[model samples]
Target: MSDHELRKAAHDLDVTVWVGKGGIDPVVDEASDQLKERDLIKVKFLRAARAGTSVEALTEELAERTNATVIETRGNTGVLHR
Candidate 1:
């Protein structure tokens, strides 16, 4: 789907994965698995997860590990698509 369409779709998606103090390591597997079952998934980065990183950076890292693309990021939430 187009970026715009993906963003629109993501607007209504509830966050299916969350990153907290454990950071991306703990959620990488889950994110990859979710991508296998769905075209897109929403992830929320809790404050603890963003202490030293920007959401964009964290999103890119997670997407790389999961073989997904970043649809968009708003505040602390990001949408990923495979």
Candidate 2:
């Protein structure tokens, strides 16, 4: 999806879902499951994630597991799609 669509969906989601620090594999799976129930998934950053982790790193990790699209990240919050 395009960045505009991602941003709009994130705002529409309203309710935030925490993916926690399950690493990228489980988080990606969780995101996918959420997408099955909801067309878009908002992945909120949790305290479990190390400060060393970068958004780029997280995006690449998820890309390998699912077809979810990285929509946006405003502060600790982010949006994704399946």
Candidate 3:
């Protein structure tokens, strides 16, 4: 789907994964598993997780680790597609 369409669909998805101070490693497995079951998944990054990094950066890193495509990053949330 187009980015716009993906974003629209993602808007309604509840965050199925969360990244905390431990960062991407802790959630990579869960995100990857969820993507196997769902076309789109939303992830929320906590303030501790953000640390010195931006949401987009974390989102991109997580997407890369999970082998998923980043749909978008907004606020501290991001959507991923496999």
Q: Who wins the TM-score comparison?
A: 1
Candidate 3 matches the true fold with a TM-score of 0.96
**Candidate 2 regions off by >4 Å?**
none
Candidate 1 lDDT over residue span 1-82, tens digit each? 7999999999999999999999999999999999999999999999999998999999999999999999998899999999
Q: What overall lDDT goes with each candidate model?
A: 0.96, 0.65, 0.94
Per TM-score, what order, best first? Answer: 1, 3, 2
Clashing pairs in 1: none
Please, what's the RMSD in Å of model 2? Answer: 2.5
Instruction: For candidate 1, give the lDDT of residue 80.
Output: 98
Best by lDDT: 1
In candidate 1, where is summed lDDT lowest over 10 consecutive residues? 1-10
Q: Write the per-residue lDDT of candidate 2 for residues 1-82, one digit (tens) a residue.
A: 5768667757967644564676565566666677778767766666676357876566545644667666666666666666
Instruction: Give the Cα error of residue 67 in candidate 1, in Å.
Output: 0.5
Q: What RMSD, rounded to one decimal, does every model reach? A: 0.6, 2.5, 0.7
The all-Cα superposition gives candidate 3 an RMSD in Å to the true structure of 0.7
The stretch of ten residues in a row with the least summed lDDT in candidate 2 is 55-64
> What TM-score should be assigned to candidate 1?
0.97
